[model samples]
Target: MEGSKKGYQFTAGQERFRNLIPRYYANSHVAIGVFDISNKASFTSLEFWIQELKRYAPSDCKIILIGNKADLKEKRQVLPKDKLPWTSESKHPKIIEISAKTLKKPNSILDSIASEGLAVKKARTLKQEEEERENERIQMYGEHSETPPMRRRKFLMCGSDRGQRK
Candidate 1:
């Protein structure tokens, strides 16, 4: 797909079996969760897709939530600003409204998705690098000691087999 300024090649494939996400979701960097705005059931079912994507896809995968059929705004069953049930505070999907049937520039959506995907990938990379550096520093200098070790305490054991006497 054509990104904001460049083109990115993707090995895109669709699986009609919704339950088999684990079998096909490996190594994916970007996942687009599409739902029909006119169909409330479809919109509600996006949670399943999101959950499956998060569980099965790579840890750094970016998800884009699309509310399709923007031209059918009059018949929309799902609102754009409605709070989704499955969104996570730490990893919220980028929700966008689009009408493939009426859009003059389809590349705009592609560009947005691509740009967001790249941003997510870059952020994850930097985070992983930072974590590695922190780990290396810990290995080199050891973890910062905050408190002294507690001394071992002696404990008396009373056992019936030993016939304990006071």
Candidate 2:
């Protein structure tokens, strides 16, 4: 596959091997879909790969679409003005163009993935913290308690249910 000008030609043998690819996606927090900008077939296959990612990856998985071989401008088949079919999707995955051979803005791809991964991690942490707090509150006061512990105590001390009790 390396140094192949055709860019990712899938043989019949490779078709069977693709089944194993989805297993890796199960635990993925981020998936990068790279296509050769100079190959129109490669660009067209991006949709298929994106569909596979969506089908196998976790629902929260972030996707980054990259168009490689930016240095081969003369041979480019996927132009910047071309509209990606997936762009209208709700997720709106981040897209970038780069040249792996020249290392052109490659860091931008890594940065986008890292940023998305961090955001997902932070959201998970906050959700876990919220769940923990809810559990603690449930333990301190019965789950059916209409008011929080401190508020209930204050209400009792005042001997009034804000005149709700007749």
Candidate 3:
């Protein structure tokens, strides 16, 4: 069989994954970077996917990191909640542990992402509004850790909802 002939020689761009990201995930809000916890060979592939997204996607794209195939505890090359820090440390991708065999904590990882998606959408709206005001350049990251020299965006609709909810 022609399929069996190629099955003998496996590669990264196999038919299963080829065009899968664009065809299926084009309109998807969340991009999940998943790797086998049992395979050391997959340690770097996840990093490659993240870089691909950053290079091709927007500045505030939503991504959740998944360390999959964790049911085989003894075979786990990387343990649960392993921090894969390949980029800016001040901002980090959340590392999630999930086992398809056990179905453990998969929803927690996805639920957190849903919440973040809402924030990302809200941020996009805020960015659009800020864009209208030709003078405002909204800083994207690390706005929480530092106190501003003065509270200027106090009337900003994006942040005003935040303070009202608190």
Candidate 4:
């Protein structure tokens, strides 16, 4: 709660955020962590949220680092510290600067978010592969029935030879 300082109201804002984030994480496939580049307090708050998530996030989770409020370019102050693959400083997270006010490079944010979505897709694929192997193991031991669940078969097509959909 940061509102205690100079009517910032970040405390109220953060409460509203904490309430909404879990529902979003549950209903959506992706989560984004955003912050204001010109406002150090906002960035600090984002860092706190990231730390809280580390204990509960799944292995497949993806996180994006952003430096918003690029319109306040003269006031920029945050730094990247999380590991990101695209960043030359791989030890630090990727940070993109943009502003909703002047709309400076806002599309870059969308592109970064898309990259995170790609990571999630890969995670789901690996999970499906592991499940398939488990199914195969069960079949080898003769514990499996005539077929796996139709839903699990998904593209396998229990008896049909239609192959997988493109």
Candidate 5:
């Protein structure tokens, strides 16, 4: 059997990868910018990545800056805990350092990601349930139903929970 001809378009960019950002930006909820601690050039490109994410990703998108190769401190060019000066906004991106080779404990970087993911999941679930309940109430009584009391929503963060008006 003769195979049918198929074609695909793939985009390639330099290390900064500015071209790929627009393709995935609209649907992405999280943007992870990974850089090597042993390479100064990779670390320097992080600001450009952040700028692209801010320009294309949704306003509520969460950004994470990671400094990899933590185990290779002997060859390190960038400090693991260097503070980023540009992310001083209200919703600052999370900064984390990790080494794939030297993770020993259960409380590793993956654990942190899981916990944060759980919080975001819980918040979305709660919002969905609230919307369903509201819809049910609207269906039962006509459009003139009394407005329900507004409840304070609890937003979960890395290690704390904060309240926000809903």
Candidate 6:
């Protein structure tokens, strides 16, 4: 999926792709859990998928929930109201409804996910860079001291000399 100027690749987390899930999770910035709105069983399975995501994906990873087959209003087994309770108790903040068959506003969904994922990736990168800088600073100066390690060592040595001269 393309978002603004950036592109994203999505992988399915089906049973057949179980072996690759861990590998994907390691590098994933966002995880999207999709279920069929027409199928109650599919909606119920989201819990299991969410648990798997939390287990394998990074702690900072963002999650998005999607309810597909919104076009099938008559056949829908999972109503919008029915999802509220589960969504409120779970980590998912919101659920997006879409119809894959109808191709209704699918690009908008992909764009939003992509943008969010990119934002997360950028934040993580910035955080990592900050930590690296901090580590460098800690290495140059003693962890709890304002002075550099070399300066502290010189001060200690000069103090010993002054004591001997006295």
Q: Which residue pairs in candidate 4 collide?
A: 82-92, 82-93
Question: Which candidate achieves the best TM-score against the true structure?
Answer: 6
Per-residue accuracy of model 2 over 58-147 as CA lDDT, tens digit each: 778788778889999999999876766765756677768998899978666666777776666567779889999888878888898766
User: Ten-residue segment with the worst summed lDDT in candidate 3?
Assistant: 1-10
* lDDT by residue (tens digit), candidate 5, 50-74: 8877898766556766777778989
Candidate 1 per-residue C-alpha lDDT over 1-166 given as tens digits, one digit per residue, 9 for 90 to 100: 4343443333233455655667667756678877889999987877777777778888777787788898997898999777677776767777888888987447777778777777776788798999998787677656873322232122233333456566
What RMSD does each model have against the real structure? Answer: 12.0, 8.0, 15.0, 12.7, 15.3, 4.9
Which pairs clash inside model 5? none
Cα TM-score of candidate 5:
0.57
Quote each prediction's TM-score: 0.62, 0.71, 0.60, 0.59, 0.57, 0.76
User: Which portions of model 2 miss their true places by more than 4 Å?
Assistant: 1-17, 86-89, 139-154, 159-166
Model 1: residues >4 Å from true position, as ranges?
Answer: 1-20, 127-166
lDDT of 4 by residue, 32-103 (tens): 567887777777666565544453455455666666777775777764443333324532444666677888
Give the better candidate number (4 or 5) by TM-score: 4
lDDT of all predictions: 0.72, 0.74, 0.62, 0.58, 0.64, 0.77
User: What does candidate 3's lDDT look like per residue over 59-164, in tens digits?
Assistant: 6767776778878789888865455658776556777778888898867775677766667767887987877643332253233534343444553554355546
| Model 3, C-alpha of 165: deviation from truth (Å) | 55
Off by over 4 Å in 6: 1-13, 84-90, 147-166
**TM value for model 2:** 0.71
lDDT of 6 at 74: 98
Model 5 CA deviation exceeding 4 Å by range:
1-29, 55-60, 101-107, 136-144, 147-166
Task: Give the per-residue Cα lDDT of candidate 3 at 11.
Answer: 27
Write down the worst ten-residue block by lDDT for model 1.
147-156
Backbone clashes under 3 angstroms, per model: 0, 0, 0, 2, 0, 0
